[model samples]
Target chain A: MTVTTTRLRGVEAAPEADTVPLGRRRRWREDAVEAVLFAAGFVSILTTGAIVVVLGKDALHFFRNPDVSLVDFLTGTVWQPQLGKFGLLPLLNATLMVSGIAMVVALPIGLSIAVYLSEYATPAVRNRLKPTLEILAGVPTVIYGYFALTFVTPILRWALGARTVDIYNVLSAGLVVGILVIPLVASMSEDALQAVPRALREAAYGLGATRLETSLQVVVPSALSGIAAAFMLAMSRAIGETMVVAIAAGAGPRLTANPLRSAETMTGYISRISGGDLSYNSVDYDSIFAIGLALFVITLGLNILSGRIVRRFREVYE
Target chain B: MTALAPGSIGLATSDAARQVARRHRVGRAGLAVFQLSTIVGIVVLGALLYNIANEAAGLVAYEHKTDPAAVLPGGRDLAALSAPELAAVLTANLSPGEVATLEREAPLAERSQAELRRLVDERVLETHAAAAWNLTDSVLDRPAIEATVAERHPDADLRLTSWLSPAFVTAPQSGDAEYAGIRTAILGSLWVIVITMAVAVPVGVAAGIYLEEYADHTRWLNRAIQTNISNLAGVPSIIYGMLGLAVFVRALEPLSSGGAFGAADPTTANGRTILSAGLTMALLILPLIIINAQEAIRAVPSSLREASFGLGATRWQTIRHHVLPGALPGILTGTILAMSRAIGETAPLIVVGMSTYITFDPSSPFDKFTTLPGQIYQWTARPQPEFHHIAAAASVVLLVLLVALNASAIYGRNRAQVRY
Candidate 1:
């Protein structure tokens, strides 16, 4: 293919080449352009490498500190940076609570919306509603944090009693984060649902199945892997989410399951501590990097798993 | 095949009919539930906007330390006064040391009328919200609110205040929430976004072009680049902040802080400036832009490339003249959306160390800066209720800005569809 293209270009450019050696010069220029573009593309690889090296290097510094034992860092419950307690459980527990609550809110609602869009709605309805749903995704997370603090928390306090609900409880933060990720879940699940072949639905209908039966029994099951991938991706996003939890979820990390109590996630802890003045190379500063490294690995693992599930389990239809 | 008796067929039974009817009912209920799920998203959106709007404007009871009329000679109207006259009012009301400090910051006579007016508000009148109410209560329970204000603070004057007024947009940040505005934050955001676009667009689009038109999928390096970009897109934004801190703020401090250029801000001779923040944002949004640009380029028909190649056009020539023009609109739409995302991003900027209470606008990429979202985050974190009100007001402004960007992107997408 390359030889034929070069021959064609040479024949066409013979006259121009005679005047100015255009063919060889143009080929060199094309190669240069290709190299430049490749460099641009290579930046992404460099970015990933930078993130790993930066996080990994600082994390190593944090673990190497004699005061912080790796076993205690992972196994201990308390996470007081000032007094030298560097347990990962409290932050990890809070992260899980928030993400769990978010998933509880987002998964069913997102899947339902996907089912509605793919199996129930007309094209006109889908077109109008999809963008409206996207508006949810477009909203800044900081605004969601504000909503969680000023709006959602008030309602929670009014219902759960102001005394029972801390001003910066995890419940409100998680609920708002859940609301924030609904669009992600809905859109991805919708794509998965839409990808299910129409013939499956027709086959179910021919067997006298109800619309719900067809969607739930045939379409959903066939699209299960894709939906699972969506769920995983949403979970990853919730885990990585920063602003909402930082603003609404409490500042101090605590290893507790009670949603009404104040607790901080990994992300909340990072943002809160980093926002304050921390002296360079201090243990406090290095701890945030350690947490960031953990966050990056977890989210990266989930994303890769999500991608694999989608690719490996995708049903190929003629 | 054996023939079945008509009476033995279960399809005609009343029980079968009832069961079928029940199934239909269940289906209808399920459909309603699904529809309700979709509506939940819209409703949450509505609630968020309403909550912000409610806080952005309302009734406030102000407690002024000194009346504006008392500052001026013969009780002249404050708005009617010139810059120097306003400066005189500030000088007359403030201490001698305070006056000297104000003069040192800038010659009081050289200050603009607007600046002088703001100073009078900040220093002379010293007006602050003694009591505040949301728009809902202000409109629906006005009599009760008035009574509460009268009972709670008799000296304070009651009036309606829109936190998101035009003046609010142009005024600089202040220590006092009542006097604070988002001008500096807005300018900071604009500068950062300008730098973000300048760096991200060319690189992102070029990467897209390479991946779509030039990459050989058989090559492992090309495949690795593709996979790497996809993973980068999923990486948490805060991690990017850490990367920026390590790379731009620390490792490349001389360049990022403008020390290399000999233009560093004396107070903040570190890399926590607009340049570092912008570069961080560029990295955060680069994968997004590349993916979108690739899709846009992919949407351009292969036939267009083939036609160009048939005319003996070089690969770069075909891409420059034919493919790029076709993909420009879509690429622009994606870039604008990415830009909007960068504009509203707060966590990364926070990690990159944005000063929460910057009063002066950032004049260059190497200046200490704050963004609108960063300001909102700061205000919301404050203990004072009035700060929350202003935070909501800032949120409204930020939301409007985002909506406008998104609308333009939608418009561009429509135009692209029409052209195709």
Candidate 2:
């Protein structure tokens, strides 16, 4: 009798079930929440789109100006906007000089620190030292700019003589920038080194190899791709760093390789130009966007390449 | 194992022994070099702090255009005077035209003692730093500094000045370095950061949730969003500045300037307001926050979610009740870090047109403003040696704020670790 009644009720419920709401409100709410979350996630993509659109539009406007030729902007050696010379070489050269100096100073020290931290230090020592390195990393770059201008510049002048070093030389700026990037390089390289499997180290030790030899030969070689990615990322950062170079690397655009001479970088030039009172829609005003577009492209390419290398490295290890 | 080369088994020879010893020596040397390389970063950090400290405190030689005693009645002490007395002193000492101008700006009688005192110093006494020595020189080579001051600024009165004193913190900026302070800059930073946090925290967390919880790996749009965020993380900060300039400062001028709300300051009705700066900073740190929050959420054990689902909880309910609480500490850590980064950022704000000489506190998001880092950059760019000293003091303040923020982040991370 109970089974017959339940079957009669189910037959009655089945007829209206298609029209009845079965947690439809809850499902609608869930979809709404997911949509909101998706919108939030989509904002990042919107930001990228906005950046590309804004930079591309202004850069196009800059290039379209009859006085500003794309060829001259890229290939010319001069960057004097006052004389209608929009050459990018001077700024690009200074950027390379500063970044090169930074790499020169950071690479060996940062890698060595990584090797020591991963292979040599006890866990306790690692715990204590890691935060110190982070503190170094957390320092504001504007402070580094101040240090570059007042402290590093004066010391360079005293060491290399006042005449040999200009008050605002790329050497001082680059050296301080190197110091600013040291913790970055060290931490990233350390992450890569720490990711190397311990079995590789044991294998080297099993062969009666010294710790240094194992680190330098077995472990570092295995982690080479990760290390290279770190280097590339750091290089990109140094290229994009603004305040330190703006403060100590001088304000003039000069195409020179001498580290002692003051020269402006692309970032520094953008900063200098934007800081001034340039009227809207002027060639000078739009030129900064063109330079910014170049900066964006270069850094983005390097970052994408670094990400690829890192992904490949992860695949190899995982 | 079969017949090997004859010279391969010569391991116990004296030459081999020497080779082993040399290798050991090289290993020791390399260890030392690597250790030293590690120490170099710490040493550089130490030197940087020391350098800033050296510049922030020192002996200063002041040359007053009119001595404070000359402006006061019976040469009374300036500190002991009442606000009214200070106002009287200002009125008596300043030119009639200057007094009228001051009254037009604000009534002197209504001003606080500190305000009156600042006015007296700025207009009446004009106490300029004729010479300054760094802390190192002041302590170690006092006699030389004194001698140099005496030789160069004979009429100057010499005294020790800590540029980061309470008076300096309370005072507003001035054209003269002797009276410039970071009070306005601090307020501006607070206002900007508040707006940044309000916008970034929820949106960033939601984005993280979407990516970690709702995103399907098979979907190309989700993958593109993921890739785009990572790329955005690596984009140069200055590029963000350009975006802010084009979008916030120009394209959305009406909204950013508060003109849409009819709250815009007529003097600063353009888009280069704190709102624009804060929004730009939010975008700048959004990717960072998203990445961190995703990691935190991903670390939440799957068992918790499984249990929530077993209880018939929906995906949103599971996240809201079970996962979010577990990830809160990690999210807090990331938020603090992003805050510190935004606070220290100067380039984007500069491009967004932070006023270098803004003296008034930012009362709302629509006001023109400067931040500590922006003020430091401006002062450091100044040709005056005195400005550099104050810039160092401002740097010290900024560093302390960052250290506090970072310490809290570390503390939060530790708590998160203990929980799981």
Candidate 3:
């Protein structure tokens, strides 16, 4: 009797639920939701598309323009875009010089910080120091710009002699940018070091190795891939860092190798152009996009390479 | 291994043994060197903080273009006067026509007393800071500074200027470095963050939920999407700026500038509106949010879902009731971190045509805007030395805000972990 009554009630409620296949409405709703979710996920892909199309379209205009020769764009020594000397080397050189100086400053310090944090410090000390490092990491690039300009530039001037160093020199910007990436490298390297199996260290110690010998020989070697990945990531960041270089690296595309002289980076060039008032659709304007394309390719390649190194070479210990 | 060698074992006190001992000594020294390198990073961070702080506080010789006494007519310290008294002084100093125009621009009666006083400082009594020195220089070279002040502007009053004062935070940008403040920029930053979070949070979380709960890992499309998202996360931020320029500032100009919606601000019809900037920022942080949210969702134990399913709940029901709540804290943690990144970002905004000198506060998303970082960038590029102090002050503000946001994120993470 109870089953009959429930069946009757279900039959009554069925029509109110709307006509469709049995449970079709519910299934449709769920499927629609899933589709919506999938579409939402696809927005990220759409962004990549937009980035490529926008950059490619304008860059095509840049390269195809009568004023810009493709060969000259790649091989010319001078990059005076205003003067129609559309060379990529000077900007690329400045970027590399800054990245080189940054690596010199950041690599040793970042690795040391990671080693100390992961291997030497107690957990309490680690907790305290990590946040402190993060404070440095979290500072806005503009602050670092001022710091490079007002503080770092003045110091560099004193050390290199005011006459020798341009007021806006690559070295000052590079040093500060190096400081900026230290926390990133240190944090990533620390993660890599901590991931090294404790068993490896114990095995080394059991074989009469001291703590230093075990860490340097056994653990560091095991974590080399991660460390390498971290350095590459840091290098990518330094190359792309904008304001610090824009403010202190000067505005000219000087093509010279001297770190003490003023030079402009690719990112710096884009920023310098954008900061000013340029008429829309101008070749000079299009050239900034062309520079952006170069920046995008180089950084993307570095990131992919770094990611592969981390994934392919990561040691699994069970 | 060295000890086990035949010669080393036979002659433990010989050359081979000495080499082993020396190797150990060298290893120990290498450890010390590594430790010192770590100290160098810490020292650099400390020095950076000290430098910014010293510049934020300074000594200034103020040469009042117009005397404050003449303006106020009362022997009260400008800082000590009540807001109402300050307003009265402002009323007394400005010509009736000038005050009328100011009121028409933004009514003083409706303004907070602090704002009225700032107006007085700007319009009625012109206070120009001349020959400012950083705190270090102010303390160490006081005599020299004083000598210079005496020689240059003997009539000017000297004061210990903390550039990071309340007035500094409240006033808008001005042509003169002395009058410039980050008020408009701060408001613009808040607006951008609002729009960014509004767009990014829902989309990012939805993507995370789909990837974690609904995505079929066996499917090639899903796998490709997953790879794309991670790669996007690693792309340089400046590239995002370029994307913002071409898409939001140019291609989507009609929508981003509000022309399509028929709500365009005349000044920002070219799509350099706050809306464009906000949308750009939203895209910039989307990958960070999606990645973090996926990790959070992945962390939820399977048992909760199983129990819900066992009770005859559908997939959506189970996810909505159990999975989402479990993942909410983590998602929020990701959002806060994203917000922090968006706040400090300047590159993309600059590309989106963020102004260097916006004085009036933005009224809507369609209006032209600047941000704290943008203002700081502008000031740093300026030739004036006094602008550097204000820029430092702005940096202090930006850092404090970021720290607060990060601290809350840390707190939330800890709390969530404890509950689990």
Candidate 4:
């Protein structure tokens, strides 16, 4: 889906300029293509409004009519929707816990992969290594969910005990999600690491820095903003992940820190209750919005932060 | 390159030093570990491809296992099955749940219950309905698998024959595994991506074009928009979902049909409709497309634009004729990468409303639908183990589609790159 649109728009945008150098009528045709292309993209923008406006409006509905008290929604720890009590802390905690777990797990492995690809591996090795990491980027979350549920959960259970992992546990979700985030981090961090100009690294190496030191200090510092954006990207991905958590993470929302436990993140709760029969205007329905709204705010903050970090600080030689 | 060379080396001594440095950089002990991680990434990706392809192959194997007369797609192994033959295969493996639905249609409580039960359940023999259930097993043994499947009940067509299931392309999902397909997910993904391009491309390109052609980088608002777009990329997808939930689903419910699939309340479209969820997903991935597009546009050289100006072309004309084409490949690559990211996105959609089991084909734009990832989520969450295989199959479908998209985009760029 992502690949198609980019290709479509890219193809639509740039063909004529390459083919013909200059002419008034042809330029008109080019502008026409540009206009059509822009119009098409503009249409996408309007449609995109549907996502924001639709969700924003629905979220507003939840805010507009709250059957459950806001305080209860925010502060209450237990979230069993059957009785209609809507405490969001569990969802919040789940989102954070999963994000935290993913970061802890993904950072090392993703950075390692990035380092291996960007710093260590030869070009042939990097070529093979890069796309391998990239393939992870393309694997659907559904596959990851199955892996997490069938493979990861059972292993975690065996390593600890059956009690250590529930049919749907936060750790399992987090673990799978961490695997998902690894590609995000590794790919982006590799870019960030690579973006550290060879000159800068050479300057550092000229000072007698080891390859490891060159990577740790020069490359990392030089690409700090990009790496920061990558972290933010991973965080947003962790927060947004659905299938892994939905499959392996528990549906029950609980506010707690035990990694070896069952809990629901905002997404898990949405998947659980939405799939079940529910009245549209019911608080149970509205609760998803509240949770969604919370998710939106956090990820939006992170996404914007990532963009800013890249734009504000990351240097571009070109 | 010269700076990277280790200093002062006799050949053997240099080799020894290089080996030591190689060992130090990736020490034999840690090197083994690093190698494992590298191998793990490659193997993991390979496994994903192998697993998906392997699982989807089940469709063929399962087809052959069911009937000797079965013909694969694009193959003329055998002609169409007779009606009874279709019925034989469908009834043979019809699950307990499927059998019940078939009973609902045929009300065969006094008829073939024992036979049907034997076919589906090993130890189950209750009453049976002679009424036609949608399918049994592999369905090729009985021609009625095709016959009953071809019946024009709107939802009934969902029961696709294993050999020639049009439902694979057109059907919505059903609770029964045999009847289920990726149609809705495919459509949902298609629609959301289409809509996302609708949303992201223009503003993205305009922003891209403007940043490249018009916007004064010296100004604060321009800078602000730049910062905003970049930040938008970093925004958690759930945030977009929340925004959509708050905005589109809630606010646009009037425009959105309710009683979605006749399940939820009539006034409010169930949270999981395409319009709502797609819109949310669009917002979630908007910044990415725009950023990539902007970068692509920026890659176009300025000299062409100057040449156009020298020839008396307007600014727009110069950009249209001279600049945009130069950057087309880059922009396409950017959008492809962004689309990959969007397709992989689940967070925002979850926040807004993507469901696991949408049994109806989403007919209206306002109609609720489930995507592959969403359906896979439903399947994987089940306590039953077979659902894992279903999830794997769906994953393969999604991956193939994404890769196709990515590859085509790259191909377009590479092909055009020769001209450049």
Candidate 5:
């Protein structure tokens, strides 16, 4: 395609265009383009950084009131927005609870599929399943929200027994979100699995090791950090998920880890407050930013940690 | 095709036996599972399509069913009872089959009196005759008694159609299922996404250029920027919304957040406007764009750069003339994915204050916006049976749009790959 395009554009024929040893004018034009592009890129960072600062200032502004204590905001389990208090743990608890549940469910199924695609499956199986797996990514989170509400919730209630209005329960959302996040773990793990030298797989096979055992004992162990990194990435996504938690788990912030109880994640709280009427400095409203700041810190931590681990893991590689 | 034949059409069995088969016994069990499950999977796919498409077709039974005993000897006028009112009449006596069907279709966690009240509200019941009934929505609750009672009541309404009304999609969201539409929310989402991409792309790509071409990697500030970028990508998008809440909303609260727009105090109003929303979304996607663009630039063969260098080309000259063009595809892919995520994202928008009942399109970047998913969340939470059903329909639309966007991105990536 490059060959065809170069020919069609007559880039090869412009010999004199290349011979002029890029003059001052040419250099200036290039520098100008580079400068503009660089500014454009820096602007996104500026925009994002600016947003962080904005949210921080507003969230912190809520603390300026004598009534809001930093102690109450951090350790308080009861998140009563109607009162002037700013305790955020209940929502944070909900966020972490669901994320933890999703990770547990996503890790094994995703890793199995990753192994199946990368090591266990024949080429024909691998070729078809990989793209189908990725389709899970394309399906919108809102659609997954519906599927979780409609499909998974009822089945869960039946299994868990009656009175389970545990129907719009956290378990269902986390379980479905886990399923939806399968590709993230599976695809990245597949890449990491494939990155392991083929010679290792061949060596194990030569020793009469079964494919399953080889994948379990050798490939996964070698790429543990990469797999863990992918899991963390998926965890970040599940934690940030909004519609599913909103539609299925509900919008009432609470500090309980009980899957059966209706509770709000940080995302759900933000979605709820945003949709409703809120006076900006009305402490309940500013709590949305408080939650947002917390979410940002958590996710940012996860991403950097993954990068650091990946870096260290890569260093261990050739 | 494979299922119809005992042997798959393309298998080379005899040649395989002649060449390498020590034992000729076929592992036909595995083949059988493959062929059998392929058909099963297809059937399931077809069933899902049939169910979803049937609902989406918007087919409705216009005739409202009424109890002759309750309606009196002459029977009730379907036109007198709006959609919710008609549903209320049947609510007390919904057949077990009908109840089960409704339960299957309207599965929103709670089944208490409050939920029941949501559908039977004066506002909703008064307009029951005006509601639309799709395949899943009251498939059994046919509007059977459409005959007008003009002699008895001059204020009676008309029951005109049976197929899903065209108005079902164009109308803004309403408590009545018949008038429910995602148009406003969909438009709001489009505007927000457009503004988001507008702010995010140019800035993200420019940052990529600075890092790739201009900045010295050895500089501590540059390294800090790089580390933070990778870090920023990991940061939960809600945090950006928090950031927006702090800076954009608080700093400009008086102008954007409060006042007639539903605020008790101007000082408390966080300026969670569309501009702030856009900035927040830009922050969420920027890291991806920068990283992807940088990699795309790095992918350009060093030989081209060296050739230009040999000819006395400036560092910037080699990139502008050759590298930028080569990296376009990678940049496009990242930008599209980031944009798609921004479109679907509900977390930060919630943090930055998207509304649920926005009747008008966001008039400016500073206007408060209601996104598709945000509205979908609101719809899902509504107590009415019809709104719950409509949520599925709207989700289908969102899914189709997302798929189309992602598909185009995939096509773009392939084209770019081919270009290189």
Candidate 6:
């Protein structure tokens, strides 16, 4: 009661010039600014809503269409969407094949690069080399697509006889995509390795462990979850990449697992088909959304799972 | 240390010490391998740049079907003449019926000066010298190329041509490789980027402010929002293209097509316009901008806020006058980087209906458009080898634009560093 009375007395004693019109206007302006800021924050939520609703509604149409059977979409091998064979196996397998190849190529090299950056290089070398790798990362995917088509594929064919490799094989695309993701994997894993407390490395070193041993056994295992997250994220990137596969991985919807042959990924399918003039609400048009829904769910699940693992394991070291 | 003693080992040769030395060697080898892998990455980056640059510059020998002396007065450069002057030349050269047919195909009066110039080059010149050497062949196998040119066409005029000349920048897309330019694509990209910036910058900055400054940590809703934004960042760009097709192209066609505003062209009422493409790109880069802006805003010192509060400044006043100015440079840096990504992006725009062969400049948001990357993609898809050389030249242009954008971002960051 005494505090309230003192505040009231202070306000009463304040000059009218300070307390009346300007104070009210200032308060009003503050509220307005906050409201505007709040609206800005709300737009992101609105975008999420739009994505969900749009994908959901169109995907429902695709499933409900008489021509498409959920059974075929899940289990069948062929994927000629225009012919009413909406089997997702071909597309999914191709996506997995490409991602698998990308992982095989990128994992060792990217980790090695990260290991060198974190445990081996001097500060100056690290600073100079990190941005050089970033230049690779920042080059547009379309350019990478061209590089795969014009350079990598010919090199592959020349290395291993031309007959074994089609002009637009998944091998070249996957390899180029791997090169693209190397920087991502390297940088993320580097951050994870760096986050390993210095004391742990010193403890291993004091026990006469070599730098490689400390980095591999002590530092790396401590940062294993982050490394795994990097792998998952890179795989997600590989699966969703469009231009490289569209340009180099060929447009054929082959269900084969051979990376030497051309196959269409989910993203490649969407890019190729969407470029065509499909009438609205057509099966082919609606099918793109269904495929997109699948991509969204897979990537979303991988990201969330990786994020959870990273968070759950982070506490152990922190 | 005693564990490694020679006497502690059962062998006279001290097996323990030898084992330690072997392990050390293994470790050294492992480090060498890691260093080699890093070198591999650098080498790959170097090779990519080399390959692109190899294709960007070269020698070319062209044989003109019609002599310039026959077409123009005093054998002047085709580019030296204005649109009207070129049109007059065409009128004097072609028969009256042929002139009428040419004008009907693309009204001469409606065409831009650049378009008129291209028309004269295409029709009057009848240039059919199709075989071209790439940068690699032209330089490394110069003797071979010269031999082929000399043997094949003794009358052919030989001159080294830069694929990326001033004419290349100003010319629009064309069927002929020699005449194709990136002017339309550049303008389209600029238009799309302008809309992207308009939509993304303000919203992204505001979202960052709210998240960093006003969000209540204890609220589950705010936490959910935070999680959603991060997840959105990891979402692949092509999926955003799908979202754009569903929402912008089909669902919100009225607004995206400008139909609701009564500003849309009746014949081109389709929602696949620059506006839809820009909004889609804006969505794709929104999370990136938001995350970067949040980091920038969060980096602002807390003491400034405290000092403002101590000075009787309200939270809004403190943020408006102090926090924003402090964060502006950082925000600008992030925004520019996001813009760079949006500019180079091709997949989402293709899915959202960027034409592969738009020859005219996009005058409004509702006009159809193509980007530099789209043009490159189109050119690469062609069967002709000459198209690949031009595509390489186009990639060079795109890379230069990216570098310029990144340089500005770096400059902004440096300025921010000085201010802080």
Every model: iRMSD: 0.7, 0.6, 1.2, 4.5, 5.0, 1.0
Off by over 4 Å in 5: A1-35, A44-48, A83-87, B1-166, B250-273, B361-368
Candidate 4 interface RMSD after superposing interface residues: 4.5
Q: Which is superior by DockQ, 3 or 5? A: 3
Per-residue accuracy of model 2 over A1-318 as CA lDDT, tens digit each = 986986787778776777877544235579889999999999999999999999999999999988899999999999888899999999999999999999999999999999999899999999999999989889999999999999999999999999999999999999888888888888888888888888888989999898889999988888888888889989999999999999999999999888999999999988888887657778988999999999999999999999898888663644
Clashing residue pairs in all predictions, respectively, total: 0, 0, 0, 79, 33, 0
Residue by residue across B219-302, what tens digits does model 5's lDDT show? 876777787787777666666666666566656666555454554344432466776777777777878888988888787787
Give a tens-digit lDDT track for model 3, residues B55-159: 998899988777777667466667777766776776778889987897887777677766776677677778788789999999999899999999999878888
Return the lDDT, model 3, position B190. Answer: 94
Q: Report the lDDT of model 5 for residue B332.
A: 87
Error of 3 at B30 (Å): 2.1
lDDT of 2: 0.90
lDDT of 1 at A315: 90
* Reproduced native contacts, each prediction: 0.88, 0.85, 0.76, 0.40, 0.52, 0.66
lDDT digits (tens) for residues B4-50 of candidate 4: 44445466687888876874765444445556776766666665565
Cα RMSD of all models vs. native, in order, equals 4.3, 5.0, 4.8, 12.1, 13.1, 5.2
Model 1's DockQ score: 0.80
TM-score of chain B of 6: 0.85
Instruction: List the DockQ of the predictions in order.
Output: 0.80, 0.78, 0.67, 0.25, 0.27, 0.67
Question: By the lDDT metric, which is better: model 3 or model 6?
Answer: 3
The CAPRI-style docking tier of model 2 reads: medium
Order of models, best TM-score first: 2, 1, 3, 6, 5, 4
Candidate 3 interface RMSD, angstroms, 1 decimal: 1.2
lDDT of 3 by residue, A131-190 (tens): 988888888888888888988899888887999999999999899999999999999999
Over the stretch A35-142, how does candidate 4's per-residue lDDT look in tens digits? Answer: 664443444445444445555665667666635677777788877767766778878888888889889888877877877778778988877666666667777676
- What is the alpha-carbon lDDT of model 4 when measured against the actual structure? 0.65
lDDT of 6 by residue, B1-420 (tens): 446765555584567789899999999999889988898898888778777777766776666678877888668877788778888888887889998998888877676676777667677876544467667787789888888889987656565667887789988888888889999999999999999999998888888888889989689877877898888888889888888888888778888888888886734748888899999998888889989989988888999999998998888889988898888888889998899889888898888988877787888888888998988888887778778888889999999999889878887788665244
Which sequence of candidate numbers ranks them by lDDT, best first? 1, 2, 3, 6, 5, 4
